[model samples]
Target: MVWRSILLLSMINLLLLFSSPPLRAEAASTSTVRPEFARKGALTCMKCHDDAAITQILLTPHAVKGDADTPFGQHDCESCHGASPEHVHSRPPEGALRDPPTVRFSGPHPSSLAERNAVCLGCHENGQAIHWTGSKHANNEVACTACHTVHIQKDPVLVRDRQATVCFSCHTEQRAQSFKPSHHPVREGKVICSDCHNPHGTGQDMMLVKDRINDTCYKCHAEKRGPFLFEHAPVREDCTLCHNPHGSTKPALLTLGVPWLCQECHDGGTHAGNPYNASKIFGNTLVAPAPQAMARGCLNCHLQIHGSNNPSAPFFTR
Candidate 1:
C-alpha cells in the first residue's frame, strides 16, 4: 500500500509539471550594433560633433559608460540614432535629407513624432512613463522631447524657476492669469506648475496631483477639511464654485463680490437682493446693525464660511 501511494504521488507531480507553461526565453535584440561608424571614420564623437557642439551630451549622465541603462553605455551613438551604414559611407541625392545619424530631433527633415517618442519609451516604459500610452499628453500627440532636452546638462523645464516658462508656451491663458493681482506665488517661484500638476499623466482630470480639487487645496489649507455639524454645501462640492484657482481681480480670488456671489445661490427673503448704498452704511441708526453691505458682506455674520462645528450655529451665523 505504501509503494502504491508513492507511485500515485510521483504521477501527480509529473502531471502538474506538464500542465504548467514553459518559461519564455528573452527575444534576441533586433537592433544591429554598428562599430564601423566609429572604426571606419577613425573618429570619436567629438571628431564629428566638436567640443562646443552637440557632443556636450558627454557632460550629462547619458555619457556615463558604467551605467548599462544609458544610450552611450549600450551602443554609443547608434543606441538612440539607428545604425546608419549608408549615412556614414555616402551622401544622399541632392534635396534628399542626408544628415547622418538615424534619429534627428530638430531639422527641416526631423523624425516623425511617433518615431521620436518610440525611441524614448523603449527604455522609459517601466518608469514614470508606464501610463503614458493612454495619457492626455499622449492622446494630444505631445512628444516627450517637447518638454525635455536630453542632450543638455540641465533641461530648463526640470528646474522649478524656469519650468513655468516651458508650460506657458502652450498654456497662454494661464500665463495671463498668473499676471493678475490676486494670484498664486508662481512668479515668486514659491509655487510651481508641478506642485498641482503631473505632466507625465495622472488618472485625475487636468493631470491634477490629487484625485479631487478640494483634496488638492487641502494639501496647504487643511483647516478647511472638516466633518462639522454645519457644513457649507458648495465648500464640500468644489472650491472652484466660488474661487478662481488661477487668479482673480477680487480679494481671496473670489469669483464675484460677496453679496452678489452669495446671491448667485441664496437669492431669497428680504435682504437677499438688497443693494448697498449710503443709507445702508452711514444713513440711519436702525434697530439691528445696518445691513452688511460695506465690510465683508455675507461673511460678517456667516463667519464659518467653510463649516461650523457649533451646535447652535445652524446657519453658521455665530
Candidate 2:
C-alpha cells in the first residue's frame, strides 16, 4: 500500500510539471505583445469615443488635417494622447474597469501632471507659451487643460465673450468683483481678462500683458497715456493706485469715491484733509460747505485730473 501511495504522488508531480510549461509560455507571449500606435489613428479612437463632446474636436483648428503642425495632420488623437494599443485591444477582468489611455487629459486616473503638460508643450511651446516654463501657472502645477478645452468646437478661454468665465473658475474673487457696480466692461463683452492679462505667462507682475499696470490701462485708456506738463504722480506710477481694474462700487472703477480716494494720498492741509460728511452738506452747515464736499468732489475743479497739457493748469484744473 505504501509503494502504491508513492507512485500516485510521483504521477501527480509529473502532471503539474507538464501543465506549468503552457502557463509559462502563455505569460511570455502576452508580455512580448507591447502596446503600439493604432493603425487607423483617430478612426480607431472614434470607435469608443464617439460622443458629441469628444467628436466636436473635429471642428477645431487642431483637427485641420492639411496643417502638419496640427494633431490630426500628424497621428490624429494619438499625437496629443500618446499610443494606447493596450487600452484599445485588451479587456479588463470581469466587473473591473478597462485600462485607461497612456495619457489621459481628464479622468479619475489621469497621467502625471508633468506628463499631461509635456504633451501640450510638445506642440505649443512657442509664441505666447514661451515663458510658460517658469511662469506662475506652471510653477503652481496648473495644467494646460485647466483653462483650455481641446475636445470642443470653440475653446471658451480663447473666445472674447466667454473667456472671463473660464478664468473665473479659479479666480472666484475676481468674479465677485466683476459683478460690482463699476467694472472694466468685462461682463458686457466689450473688454476681456486677456486684454490686460497673459494667462500663458509674462515677465511682468500679475502676469499683465504689458510691463506695468499703467501701460496695461493705457491700452484702453489711451487718453491717460500723456507727456503732460502736469503729470499725476500716482497715475504715472500705477493705475491700480486709485483704480480697481477688476471692479469697484465707485464710479469710473475708482477704489473710493472722489475726496476719500484723493485723501488717501493728498491728506495734508486745506480742503484735501477735510472729510466730506452729512454735517458739511448745503443745509446742515451754517457756513457754506466746501466745493470738495459737493457732487463729483475733488473732480469738481480738477477736470483734467489725470494730467493737464495746458501750461497754466498747474493743479490739473484745465
Candidate 3:
C-alpha cells in the first residue's frame, strides 16, 4: 500500500508538470508567437475545431496565406482586422461580418461592398476571381464568405459537387429540372455548372466561362465541334437547333426525331403532300420497300451521317 501510494504521487506530479493548463495559457499570452511554433494560429479556435482542419487551412496556397509563417498571421489577425483591444472586456454583437465593435478591425460600415473588397484585393486582385465584382453572385449580396469558410480547412469551394449544391440553393428551378428522368446527371455527380460557367463572375449573361456559348458546350462535347467538308449550317451555328440538351422525351436528348425533328427548320420542296420519296430518320423514312428493313431506318445509307469530311461526299453523304 505504501509503494502504490508513492508511485501514484509521482505520476500525478509528472502530469501536473508536463500537462499543465497554465503552460498553454502562458504560451498564448505573448503578442508574437515564437518562430518555431508560428505555423499555426487561432489557438482559441482549435479548442473545438480539429487541429488537422486548422493546419490545412493555414497551408492553403492562396497568394495571401493565413499561416503563422506569413507576416499577417505572425503579427496576429489584428494586423489587418485591427486589434481586439476591447474584446477581452466587452462582448460584440451577433452575426458580425466585421471585427467586433470592441476590436479595432476595419469596418464595412459607411463604405460600399466594393470598398470592403478593395482591402483584400490589394494583394489578391490578379487572380481569376478579379472579375467577381460585376458577377451576379456579388449583386445578390453573396459575399466571399458564404461558400467559403476560412476557419474551416478543406475549403468547400474545392469540392465541385458541394459548390453546385450551393448554386442549387438559389436556382431551385434548375434543381427540380435535374431530378427529371432525363438530365445531364448533375445530381448524380456527373456534371456541374462550373464545368461551363465561372461562378466568381463572367461577362456572359449566364456567367459562361467562354465568350461564346458553343465554346462552353465543347468542353464536354468536343465531337460536336467539327470543320466538316460539308457542314450543316444549323449544326455549325448552334447545338440547340435539334435538341433540348437539358432534358427531353426524345431519344438521344433530341427535341424531336424523324420528320418532326428535321421539319422544324427543314422545309420540303413542292411535293403534293409529303413530297419526299425516301423515309424519315430512325423509322423507315417511308417504306424502304421491305417492312423488315424499315426497323433499321435512315441509318442504312447515311452511315457517315453526322458530318463527313470526305472531299467527294455530296450532301454529306457516305
Candidate 4:
C-alpha cells in the first residue's frame, strides 16, 4: 500500500509543474532589478552628444574632478542628468522616440520645470540661491537655463561686460532706460546690473543689494550718506524721489532739473512758488528775472544741496 501511494504522489507533482510553466516564467521576469549607471559615465554620453557646446562643459567649474561636490567628482554626467539606464541601453520602436534622461534642462520634450530645478537645487540650494525659492524669477517660472549656460566655458551672466545683455533680455524697460542721455555707466562696463540689484533675490524692495534703496546708492556715492546737521527730506526718504538711478533725460539723472525738481517739494517757500520760464527770462515784464532762474538755478546757492554739516545752513546751503 505504501509503495502505491508514493508512485501516485510523484505522478501528481509532475503534472502540476507541467501545467504551471507560464507562472514560473512570470515569477522570474517580475523579479526586481536595480537600475544601472553608464559604464563609461560622460564618455558614453559623448558618443552621441559630441558637439562642441556639450563637450565644452569639461572646461567649466562643474567638471572639477578634485572637488567631490562637483558633478564629475561624483557620478560624472549622471550626477546632474541622473542614472538613465533605459536611456543608455533601451532600443526605440519603429518611428518612436527613444527614452530621455531623468532630468533635462532644455530641448522640446524636456522634463517639467520643477524636476529640472530640483536637480539644480540638489547641488545649489545654499549661498546666493537660498532665497530663490519664492523669488520673482522662480515665481514667474524663469528657469536657471534662461540666464545660465552651463555647457559654455564662460556664462554671459557672469561676465561683467556681457552681463547687461543677459539682464536686458527680460528687463526691456530698464534696457531702454539704460540707453537714455543721463544714465549709469552700464554700457561702458563700469557698472553692472548686479552692482545694485541682486538677481538671486533679497529682503529689500526691487531686489536691491542693500536693505534700502538709499543704502544701495551709498555704495558708490558714500559722500551722500552723511549725518548732516541739515538733511534734505527727499534725499533721506528715498533716492528715487528725485533721481532715476537707471536713466533719465535730465542732467545728473534727476527726474527734473534743479529748480523744477526742488519746486516739487519747495512749492510754498519764498520765491519758490514763482514759475521760472522763457517768458520770465526774455519777455518784457515788470518783475525782474529771479536769481534762482539763472543757468545753475537753485544749485548756485545750495552748493551743499545733498546735506550740510555747517552750523547755520538751514536750507541745505553752506
Candidate 5:
C-alpha cells in the first residue's frame, strides 16, 4: 500500500508539470484582456446561444485573435462587436447585446445623408469610389446601403455575376430595353451592369470616368477606336446617333441596321438603279446580305465603325 500511494503521487506531479506550461501560455495570450471589459458577466453569451455554437463562433472567421487587426471573422461576434460586458449580468437589456451603434450595417434607415453613407465610405475609399461625393448617385441622394449591403452575406450584389441587380434597380430603362427581342444578353446574365456603367462617381457625364460615351466603349473594342484608312464621320461623331447604347430590337444593339438603315442617307435610289439594281436592297428576291456582307450586318466591314481617319464617305462603308 505504501508503494502504491507513492506512485500515484508521482503520477499526479508529472501530470501537473506537463499541463502547467500550456495553461500559462494561454493566460499570457489573454493577458491583454482589459480589466474593465472582462467581466464574468451574469449572462454568458452561450447560455442562450448554446455551447456548441458559441464555441463555433470563436472558431469561425469573424473571431479575431487580437484587436486592431484584420477583419473579425463573420461568426466572430465578439471582435468588432466588443466583449460582452453585461453578458454575465444575466439581465443584459432585452436587446442590450443587440448590434452596437458602431455597427453601421443595419437599418431602420439612417436619418441623414452622412449617417447613411458613412457606413460604407469608412471602408471603401479606394477603387472605383475615390470621387463619389459630387457624382450622380451622391447628388441624387442615393446612399451606399441603398445599393449595397455589407453584412448581407446572402444577397446577390456580393456575388460576381449578379451584382448588376443593384444597378438595374435604378436603371429601369435597361430593364425595359432587355424586354425587346434583340437586346444584349443581360437577361441571361452575360453582361453585368458595371460592364458599361461606373457605379462610382467621376467628373465625366453620367459619372462615366471616360470623357465620352464612345471612349467608354472603346476600352472593350480597341480595334474600333483606330484612325482607319477610311473614315465614317457619323460613326466617329457619336455612335449613339445611329445606335442604341443599351439593348436593341435589332440583334446587335443597332437602332436599325442594313438596307433600311443605309437607305436613310444613301438614297440615290442605289445610284439610279445601277447594274445590280442596288436600289432594291432585297435584290434577286432576297435580302441575302444587306449592304456589308451581313456578318453582324453593318458592323462587319465598317470595323472602325465608330470612327475613321480615312474621311472618304465616312458613311461607315468600304
Candidate 6:
C-alpha cells in the first residue's frame, strides 16, 4: 500500500511538469523581467540620491516602488536609469570620473535622442506617445527631457499658466505673435497653447489637439461652426482662410483689415475693391458717407460673415 501511494505521487509530479509550458509562455509574453540591481548592491534609493536636488523624485509618482507594475515599482531609479553594477562599485578612478550608471536625458554630455526617448516610451507608449516615433518632434530629434523635468515634483510645462513660457523657448515667432494687441489671452494665462496643440505627438497636422483645424477651433468658437442656410465656402473649407489663430494687428484675429480681407476673395465685386478716401472716412458731409472704413469696414454691411441661419441672409448681410 505504501509503494502504491508513492507511485501515485510520482505520476502527479510528472503531470504538473508537462502542463507548465503554457504557464511559462504566458509569463514570457508580458513585460520582460529585469535583474534586480538594487538587491545586488545591498543599498536603498537614498544611499546614492541623498541630495535634495536628486532626492526630490521621491516626492513624485515615479518613486512609488510598491506598485510592481511601473518601472519605479520594479527596481527604483535603476528601472529607468538602467542597472549599473559599475556605478555602484566604489573603485577609485585612474584618469577621469567614471561613467554614469545610465546615459541621462539632459546634461552637458546627454544621451542620444533615440536613447532618451526610448526610456520614456517604455511605460508611456500608450496614450499620446503612441505616434511619437514618427512625429515631428521625434523627426527633429527632440528629447522628452527637452520639455519635461521628471526629477522635479512640479514640471513647469505641466502648469497651464507656465506652459506657454516653455513652448516660447522654442517658438520665438509665436511669442512675438501672442504679444500683439489683438491676440489670444495666452500671456494673461486665460488661453494656453495646449488648448489648440498636443505637444505629445498627435495624428493631426501641426500637432493640433483635434483631427481638423476647424474642429479644433470649434471647441471654443462653436457658434462659428454653423450649418447655416447660406454657408460661406471659405469658412466651411478652413478657418485659416480668413483668420490667423495667433495674434494679428486687425480686430477679431483677422489676417488683414476688413475691406482688404474681404477683397482677397471678393475682388472688384460691386464696391468691395473701393479703397477708403479721407472724404468718406474723416469729415462728415450733409449726405451720409460710405462706411467703408468706419465700423469694421466691410463687416459693417456683411454682419453675418461667418454664416447666417436666416433664409433671407443670402449674402450673409443679416
Best-matching candidate per TM-score: 2
Ranking, TM-score, top scorer first: 2, 4, 6, 1, 3, 5
Candidate 3 residues 1-318, lDDT tens each? Answer: 676456445533543453344347646776564432322233332333334433344334431333444433333333333334343334546854433422221335433455445544554556767778768887886655556555444566567666667768778877776665567766555777777778778778678888777777788888878877777777777666766556665566666654456556546551112324444433645643432234433344445545778888755556
Count residue pairs with overlapping backbones in model 5: 18
TM-score of each: 0.77, 0.84, 0.62, 0.82, 0.59, 0.81
For model 2, residues 1-318, the per-residue Cα lDDT tens digits are 675446444533443454354446545776563337665567677777766678778768887666779887776788888888778887998998877788998878889999999999998889779889888999999999999999888998888889889889999999999999988788667899989989888978888999888888888889899988999888888888888989999998889888888888887545577744334335657444678878887788899998999989999889
Candidate 5, 286: how far from true, in Å? 18
Deviation of model 3 at 242, angstroms: 3.6
User: Please, what are the lDDT tens digits per residue for candidate 4 over residues 179-293?
Assistant: 8999998976789999998887886678889999999999999999987899988788899998999999999899998788888888753566564433343365534466677
Runs of candidate 4 with Cα error greater than 4 angstroms are 1-35, 93-96, 275-287
**What does candidate 6's lDDT look like per residue over 1-318, in tens digits?**
675446444533443454355336546754454433644221244465555566556557775544666655555677777777666664756876655677576557777777778888888889668878778888888788889888777888888788889989999999999988789998777888989988877978999989999999999999988989999899999998888888988788889887878888875535566544434434554234457657777787788998988888898889
Off by over 4 Å in 5: 1-111, 152-155, 257-317
RMSD of each: 15.2, 15.5, 9.5, 16.7, 10.9, 12.3
Separately for all candidates shown, the number of backbone clashes (residues 3 or more apart, or on different chains) is 0, 0, 4, 0, 18, 0
Poorly placed runs, candidate 6 (over 4 Å): 1-36, 40-45, 94-96, 275-289
Tens-place lDDT digits, model 1, residues 118-217: 9888889888777787889999999998898877778778888888888898989989988888998886667888888888887788888899999989
Regions of model 3 farther than 4 Å from truth: 1-41, 44-82, 91-123, 255-258, 270-306, 311-313
Off by over 4 Å in 2: 1-35, 275-286
Tens-digit lDDT string for candidate 5 (148-214): 6433334466455677567778889877887887775665667656666677787777776488887
Higher-scoring candidate on TM-score, 4 or 5? 4
Model 2: how far is 305 from its true place, Å? 0.4
- State the local distance difference test value for candidate 1: 0.72
Ten consecutive residues with minimal summed lDDT in candidate 1?
21-30
